[model samples]
Target: MASAQDPATAQHPASQNSNGSSDPRKSLDGVVEKEEERKEEELISPDTSDAQPETRAVTGWKWILICAGLYCAIFLYGLDNTIAADIQSAILETYGDVGQLAWIGTGFPLGSVATILPVGKAYGIFNAKWVHLGSVLVFCVGSAVCGATPNMSALIVGRVIAGVGGAGLYLGMLNLIAINTLEKERPAYMGGTGVIWGAGTILGPVIGGAFADSSATWRWAFYINLVIFGVLLPALFYIPSFNPQPGVSPVIKLKELDWIGTALIAGVYTLFVVVLTLGGVEWAWSDGRTIALFVVCGVILLLFMAQQFFAILTTPERRIFPIHFLKSRTMIILYACTACGSTAMFTVIYYIPLLFQFSRGDNGIESAVRLLPFIIVLSFFIMASGQLLGLFGYYMVFYLVGGAFLLIGASLMFTVRAGTNIGAVYGYEVLIAIGAGLIAQIAYSVGPSKVPPQDMAAAIGYMNVAQIGGLLIALAISGAVFQNIAFHDLNRLLSPLGHSAQEIHGAIAGSQSSLFVNLPSDVRDTAIELIVKSISSIYALVIAAGALCFVTGALLKREKLYDSKPVAAA
Candidate 1:
């Protein structure tokens, strides 16, 4: 053994390989001395920490496979969420009015948003592998329950179960890859996930229409989730409990759980939705239930902010929410755009089909099938936007394109008379799809790009929370508008025909075709015209929403998309 700094080693610090052979020391010729050799007769081996993450190039393939698994999970999750919308007709037919039927769609995302903080907090304390597995299992159980349920209440419970599991899985899966996979590799994985998710949206309506058209209508929605979950569970089991960074925990391992903050957010959000839900249907907008709920929601939301401020100041474990995120200009703008874009996109999807049924005289299957073009265009544009982000290094363009397309789509609806050509109707849907594709990919990508790598999961979960929250909020508002237009038109016209206000309201509210067709010939034509008028007006409101998105996009600071660039270390 020779010390390189010593006079003797300086002459020739010749060292054998680990086998004590001197055959050019296997190439580098001991240019790098073994760490173990410095300490003892048996040299200390280099620790894994000293090695490059993606050593072998062959090791990269393993991660690609894991990413495929994650993509499947995202795909199935999107499919399940949207498929219910496709089956809304079946549920409404079975359960009666929109008010009674609304629970089917709201329950899942509600559960997802509610469970985020808890699951996120757990990610630090528990192993992500086990946590993700439990999430998949929970989702499976929910699917089973929904598939088996005979009643709406039972079905809603299943949706909640699925939501809870999905929240954990969706949150955990990305971070599991982002945190574990090599930096240069993440973009492809993320891009792949986006493609899978887009593909799922593509398949949902066609598959949903086919299944729901059969006797199994709603059950098929859950069945698809079950089949994918079946495949995903085993893939997840293959991921080892290896932490990329481990063997250390902060001195304070847990923040005092933000039970109060969590409860307040849930209360405010739910109450807000409730207030909107009652509007134009169960109670007038100014009625006691709706008014009181609005008041309470506003109060609770303020309290949630108050609680978050206090938690950030006092908590040593860096509270469930990071203080940095709240203060980050990039984060706030991205979140706002996500909320707005999501609200507009989902709101349009939810009601447009119903409008088609009423004004275009299309059935549920026809409407669902019609959206295939939208989904196709959405998928194509999402990829195009990804390439644009790669080339331009700016996220703002997606917002711009999406906002512009959405506005275009909404404005085009003004021409949607009852006799508008089928080609014209399809054009509007295509415009929406193009705008949606641009927005959806950009919206999902923004939070991750803006937030710190360490906060990626929390941010993603938060992003999803915003998206869904906006969706529900927009649903309430849009539904209220639809109700008002339908209500006024129903009363104004039908009352003159000698039908009572109550009778007119009751008929349309039930989603019955006879609500229009049962009238006298001229009156029926007028009722159909009213239907055309009310629904078309809602599209104008959606255009306003798109305008708001454009404003936010203008405000967003540009973030360069470095597809292969590594996330900065915290």
Candidate 2:
């Protein structure tokens, strides 16, 4: 065995003559020995350190495969949102209640929010390959269950499972590419990923509408996800595995894992979600049970903060949510804007399909098919924005433009009346779709740039949580607002049409398609007109919200794209 030598001693003739301190150059054995040490440590303490990135250059096709996998997963996940809106009429027919139908859409997002943090931490611990594979597998299984679901309860379970896994896949794709790609090259790769994501969205409604129109309906939509998921196998072969640093311990910095803090966060967030889901649907928003749950969530959040403080004092390592993130003006502003965006997206999606089927006089199949325009517009912008960001390095111009588009679209939608032109009304949808596409393009960009690269996953998680949390609040409040306005208007208009308010509401409550199918042609057309007018105000409220978010986002510190050049600490 070669003796150890100080590399410094070898260069000095005097020290060399005295005998090179140990082995003159430790470049070889030190690296080899560390690998040996890690192998031995693997049995005792398992860790998949995401540090010490490899030098292997990813080729063009590998980027394509990864993008393709990410696209399928995003499309598959997002498809549920669109298809469910269209097929709500069919599900209502089977399940027999508006409350029951809402659960299918709500369940998946609940699962996603629940699992997001744990999965983010896991990115540093497990083999990313297995994590990606396992998530996809679970999603496929969930999709299968939802497709063949016999009852409302079973469908909720399936959506929850699929959402949980999908949460993993979405984050995994971003982290995997960030860790793998060189810095300057990352934008183009992300752009490619965006393109694929856009393409997949187009398939959701077209395929879903077609399937639902045929004998397939909602069942075929879920099965199609299974087929898309199966296509991910080819990319798995190329996703890189960690080779590890030669002798570094495989054990990660577990003190970074804050178990108590995690439990507190889970308790607080889960209860909050539970209460919100129940609000306006099962319990009054200000009901005793809701109030108690909200109090419990607050207490839990307080406990979490206390635990973090204790960790800072007691632990031998660094803090988790370091002060930099907390003090960041840019981070806070972005968080707020993203929250508003989520609110706008969730609100419109809930009501627009209702309007289309009831007012536009479309079938469940036709209503879902009509959403293709929004999906098409959204996908086109995502691809274009991603590429533009990669090439020019500044995407805020698009963010502002997109924000303005959404504002205009929402304003137009709000102004609509009983006899609104179908073509003109839908022009609003395309505008918001374009805006949403542009905002999404910049969201993944903004949060990552201002924060430390080491904290990228956590930052991404924060942005998502903020966005979704807003959605939860918006859904409960807005869902109630929508129901009240639509019901009140339908009640007033139905009297003139010689229908009872109860009868009109019964049709509106179920799904858009049912509102038409359940009524006579004259009543159906009349119900359509009234439903459209009432919802116009709702769209206006949402448009105002989106415009505010855009204003705030525009005002946020316009940090340029993150360059690979090492940043020096002030």
Candidate 3:
């Protein structure tokens, strides 16, 4: 037998044949080694040495300050989304175009979902610090525009712009944390961000309501963002200059972006939202316009998916969809769960206040105040969920329990009629809050935990997209359901009360449930009942979404939480 260290024996694992032919085992070994090397090269971060300065570690007060700035940015983003919910009524009152009201709320998320994938890729190619600061500046500009807008169209345009900026802010904040903090410490920082997010959810309504109720105009609601942005601007400087792809030229990197894919996705999302918000409200669902929109949306989405697959096979580096991540059964289930949970949460946030304002006859401020129980419980659990994850090192239980809570809460919300007991309603809100808050931060944890270091950014982006997509789809579907039901019920209830077809059409076109206030007592009571029934129907969807979360949670593969080594900062 040849010695173990013999070159011939090492190179050719299989014994040579009678002649001098190469061993098949040796060829197989070589092929496997080459394949592994290729995979490693593909996963490597862009060359940083030539393009960026030496990374100085962010520590002590400097790290604290950087985190503070990022948290503020997050707070601003969350506040923008929630503020629209409470102040939308005030906006309609001022603008006097009820038909345009949904745009005010949809515009921000539309902008967010449209740009998120592109912004995530942009961070990899540009200086993260500059990219983040530029986003903040854009947000400020949009806020200013919103504050100064003279018409509903301008306000919607400003909101879309602000949302685009917000997409950058959100991705930049998460990327900064991941790169700057030590791996072990990241969960704590992430949890801290979640707390800020929860606080924003609470404060958004409170502040928007306060402004709406005060002598101040609803424009101030947007102006407040500028003030917060000013405070966060200086902190941006303290953030470390960490560029993973320092040597790459911006022009080359720009070319590598899947612009066509991005456009297709944006078109699909925008059209879907338009169809949802306008169908049955501005145009009949069976109308040619609505059918055309749906056809276009479907074709665009299919094109986007095809582009994603093509990019993955031909140019994996440029693909926005992380094909590898999708291959994991666990990751796919987690994304589905995240979408369901998000739909439930956003549905509650947007509609709960409307429930108060319309069903119970509360003003914007009063409706917001009534949501304190939900907000407070949600805020508490957002932090608690993080702490428990740190202590117990498990997430499956949280999802299972949280989903159950959400189901119960959504079912309870269905019972909230015009004269439902306040205590019971408050209790239901608390239950929903706890479930939503607990489930909210887990995806952020689980997604990064599962992927390789190079794929962490993509994983995070995917989770965020899932969340925003959920909100978009939920808002669209629920809005369609609510409008269709309300129109049918309103017509049936009001026609017998001496209201003319023109009057009924005007009221439906107005799209304000609060219009019931102007009706005769008999009509008002009946209208309120119809509105309650219509709105309550939406919670059934929420319940189904919650149940999906629970099923996904139960199906998720168990992984040792916090056991994996942190991926090196890009």
Candidate 4:
């Protein structure tokens, strides 16, 4: 373990005296510097230092098939993030509950955030192959439920269930790659996942719109997951199992779970999301129900923190949330960077379509197609960053570059209007896409490299929490922001246009049957201006997120991550 920093130090060798021998003073300084670095590592390192069990890596066609299956599963997870965006009108038409419509988008991330840590822990303790298979099966079942759901409530439940499965699948993919690939090869594989994920996220609305606009119906958006799963079912058998605690009994492993901690944390996040989701849309900010929810969320958060400190439900070694991450400046900065990057990326994915839909009168498919410039550039850069990092070994550069792009791009987007040139809007989005794609998945690769094999799961879990939780929080807040502002401004200006309040509400609610569409040409143009103004205002949040990401990137340690020498995980 003492030699783990050798590769980094070798990358920047200490200076020597003119005689080619190290100067005494410089030697002393080098020793002191090395000592300080060791102290920092110890201060932040996890309590467990046990060596992981060795396993045979899958090979040849088996490896190829397994990788394909894993990539497809991740694509499904990413697709779920924005599939509902283009089909909200269709779902509303069927369910007639506009208030619950947001849940269609929020439910998946909430479930993922609420359970990501526990799922990460489970992967560490259980048989890897079985757990991965179970996760896939769970996701398939959730998709089935969503496809067949009779109402919005059932659909929301299915989204949540799928989210839970998605969390496990996501972590499993990372863990599998960690165990299976060589250090030099890992970044390329991880980057491959990022590429697939970005594609799925960008393409989600396109697929959903096609379904909604066709006789196949919007329900096929979920059923599509099952179709992919069935196609890859055979590959499940090829995923080699590598349990960290192989002989541990099922009963002992069950007892090892931090159930109380899981429940407390879930309650806190669930309440927090609920408050955000319902506060402005369903209830006033001053409503008693909203106030009560905030109070409960605060209390549960305190209990969760206390449980982590006191080890009440599980020992420090088995705690789902890693407490030491709070003390490590590197982990803190990485968490913040991941969060901000995710928030910025997802904000655009969910809202940019609305810009086209409202201002340009583009339908779901057309708006989705319009995003190709952003999507193509983002996907290419995401894959490029991974490959370049694999070769160059400086992860910080991507963050700095990406952050700068996000800040500049988001600032430009903030200035856009309904009548802005279509070409210019496309250019602004590409800038943002570059920033978001670069930083989006970098943490997954870098965070694990900072820790030993035994703590990789926790590190991955910590980053996953940031990645999913950030998007959940962003969506909740941005949705509230967009809804409240749009409703107020539209009602104030359009009520005198000979339109009923319901008609204005219906138009903004994404109802295809809204009578607001039948307004006189000049009045409709005015309404479009108002709609675009509200949506564009959300970029202010993206700008803030991008600025934070840049700050964190500047704070990261300057060092190389890969070398000929092994990383000293044992």
Per-residue lDDT of model 2, residues 1-570, tens digit only: 000101110111111123323232233335446556876997678666754643435568886786667656666665664455555556656665555445655667667766666666555445556677778888888889988898877887898788788777766666566556654565555555545544543444455556656776667777887876776767765776532122223464344455665566667656765675566555776799979998988998887777666663424123333334556666676676666656666555665666766665566556655665776777677656656766776545665676687788888878877577778767877887777766654665666656544455456677767765565556555555555666677777666767765455466554344445666878666666666666676776567667876786687545455552212211
TM-score of 3: 0.84
Alpha-carbon shift of residue 434 in model 2 (angstroms): 3.4
**Which stretches of model 3 miss by more than 4 angstroms?**
1-65, 182-187, 312-314, 496-517, 562-570
As a TM-score, model 1 comes out at: 0.80
TM-score of each: 0.80, 0.75, 0.84, 0.84
Q: Report, for every candidate in turn, its global Cα lDDT versus the true structure.
A: 0.64, 0.61, 0.74, 0.76
Clashing pairs in 4: none
Q: List the residue pairs that clash in candidate 3.
A: 51-246
Point to the candidate with the largest lDDT: 4
Please rank every candidate by TM-score, starting with the best: 4, 3, 1, 2
Better of 2 and 4 by lDDT: 4
Q: Rank the candidates by lDDT, best first.
A: 4, 3, 1, 2
Please write out the lDDT profile of model 3 over residues 1-570, one tens digit for every residue: 000000100121122344444332233235346657865875785554575653427777787678778888988888887788788777866676655667877888889989998888787666778889989988888899999999888998998899899898887767677666654565566656666766775678778888888888788999988887777678779886755444556886687687887888899989998888888878887999999999999999888888887773336667767766767767787788778777877777778788777667787778888888888888778667766876887678788888999899999988788788888889988888888888876777667677654455577778878888887788778777877787788888888777754455445432353455478777777777777777888998889978988888888656457774443322
Clashes of 3: 1
Q: What are the candidates' C-alpha RMSDs?
A: 10.4, 10.3, 10.9, 10.1
TM-score of 2: 0.75
lDDT of 4 by residue, 1-570 (tens): 000111111101122333444332132236447657966986898445684753336678888899989888888888988787788777877776666656777888888888888877776567667888899998888888999999988998998899889887776676676556654666567656666777778888888888888888999999999988999979978886665554557888788789999999889878887887788777889999999999989999999999988889688877768887677677788888888888887788777877887777777788778778888888777767666777899888888888899999999998888899999999999999999888877777677677654455567678878988898888877877777777788888888776765566577766255655577778777777887888888888889888888888898778765632213331
